[model samples]
Target: MLKPNTLALTVVLALLTALGPLSTDMYLPALPAIAQDLTASAAQTQLTLSLFLFGFAAGQFFYGPISDRVGRKPVLLFGLALFTLASLGCTLAPNIESLIAARFLQALGASGPIVIGRAIVRDLYEGARAGKELSRMASIMGVVPAIAPVLGGLIAPWGGWRMNFVAALLFGAGLATVVALRLPESLARKSAQTLSFLSILRSFRSLLGHRGYRVYVMLSLLAYGGLFAFISGSSFVLQTVYGLGPMAFALSFSFVVVGYIGGTFLAQRLVGPHGLDGTIRIGVACLALGGSLMVVLVASGVASFLAVVGPMALYCMGVGLTMPQAMASALMPFPDRAGTASSLLGICQMSFAAILGIVLGQNLDGSALPLPLTIAATGLMALAVFGLTGRARRG
Candidate 1:
């Protein structure tokens, strides 16, 4: 057996964490195809993504507390089952509306693994060690984004867009099987009493009351805002505006993913030397710098592919560095309530990203101006928040 606290365990946890991107990123290459085949408007097509993020955000409130009362493994398994079934629903969806509904369902299931995985990390590690572990896991999970879009792009031509969902179905089912056999329950101390609505509220309220938690959560939320703007808008911008095909678009996406992977790698090393808050400050600087450059480049009528993707890669690197440290720092003080804390952090992050993405989608002109503008605005705001909040307890 791959014992807990081993690299094997981290890999498994990373896979569990990967359920989110595998579902969303894998389908991105097929988006234009899905829109055409389903005869949906751009906004309607984008709803599939936005609604999934909303469902992902909303579902975490349930999973986090329940996993605290119950254990991680069972909740995760149940979620995987639902995710598998929902993937099938997406594969068989006849219209855009149906696909949108299925995506929401899929997201609800996907939420369980992500929140539980973060809680699991908190269960086993703390402080800088926890940040390192999260960075390692993120580095591993980064592969999914790099690969999923390319794989989906390859699959799109052969079996069309439905095939992308087929891959998601297989992945969910396979992951569920792995969890059932190999993954051990990570929650060391489960709440003895069942969770009441009032108790859940109290848990959330307590997390919200903490100044450090609020700062870290806002940091994460704003970082994600910039990232999701790229995610929600990039496919259309690259494929439609730039006139790239599926494979080419996927390649460009992977290039940006490379930067994120690099950031995660750097974060693992930097956390020990820089401390969590220090590392976060470094990352936020990158976020602001890269995002501003993108805005400048795009606004100056330099809409070359490099102009967009180049700056994006740098912004993504900042995301990679910022997210793990923020998450670990936020959860460090709440070891017992890691599940709930993780859920609240996720709820704020995803909900804000979903809203920002929808707004960006609605404003998408034929130019790439909106994407960089959104990125720069959010990135600068994240920097401002981190600066104003001052240094959090260095992990």
Candidate 2:
């Protein structure tokens, strides 16, 4: 087998971890066009995103344990095939309902890469090394969110919304081919008890019972929640409320992701001197500050594109700093059961974001308040949770 931490392995891992963002970010610029073309309401179109999150959350729960039992490569290949097929299903979807269902199926498959890719990282490293590696992977994966929507916007005007799914299909196929040819099995030890119901239950209980793991997972969840609120609502808010064209909105979205990319790089630098907890403390402060600024801007009747995406860039930067360290901390304690721990953390993060996406969708009223409000709440909540939990642990 190839040596660990090679550039090739890191690239593959980054691509696998990017599946979630690739699936959502690329199609984001198409949401308005989809609603217009399908004769669906904005709320209905947003269901595609929310349901995708739900499916992603549900799939992570199973993919982790099953991969632990059978090994990572086979399960990952299966998921890639499913995702590729589902993307085709999305491209051929005839109506809004069909598109929604296909998006959900695509998410189910996408979750395998996301959850298992993290497990594979855990397989190879731990603690601050794991945090730095994850930051590297995230830094690489960050390009997808930055570029996918621009590509989608470029394609959507000429090829239409369905063409975005065609791009997704091709991406899935190409990634699958690479994995099949170049990637080795990352699971070092296969657990026979991984899939058993009792074993799964015990694993969950043990992971949840760990204080540090629980706190880290919550921190990750809140960080993601703040970021996702922007993901779910930005296209509409930027397009409808702020009069941005598809390309303009795509560029704006990419600008916000630059903040996230910068954060990942910052995490790499800080993880050594500040450590995971210190990095997180610095990061959440950014999250809270950016989020609060967004709320203030909108509440003060300042509803420009910059007003929204500006603060979001800072918030996303915070996410960049927070996620890798939090993930490394949570999964560090469960080296033997990393897959299970990864899945549980994935589920909590996605489930809450999924529900929050739906809430944002329902509350969207052609105003700029809901998106910023939701982001601010999640950011503030994360800061509060970290403070209280960290104090409790100290006490």
Give the C-alpha lDDT of model 1.
0.91
Tens-place lDDT per residue, model 1, 163-262, is: 9888888888998888899887878889875688888888899889898899999999998889989988999998888888889999999999999999
Give all TM-scores, in the order shown: 0.98, 0.97
Where is model 1 poorest over a 10-residue stretch in terms of lDDT?
Answer: 386-395
Q: What lDDT score belongs to each candidate, Candidate 1 first?
A: 0.91, 0.91
Cα miss at 202, model 1 (Å)? Answer: 1.9
lDDT of 2 at 365: 94
User: Over the stretch 101-219, how does candidate 2's per-residue lDDT look in tens digits?
Assistant: 99999999999999999999999997799999999999999999999999999999899988988988988999999988888887888886836778877878888898888899999
Model 2 weakest 10-residue run by lDDT: 386-395
Q: Give the TM-score of candidate 1.
A: 0.98
lDDT measured at residue 173 in model 2 versus the true structure, 0 to 100: 94
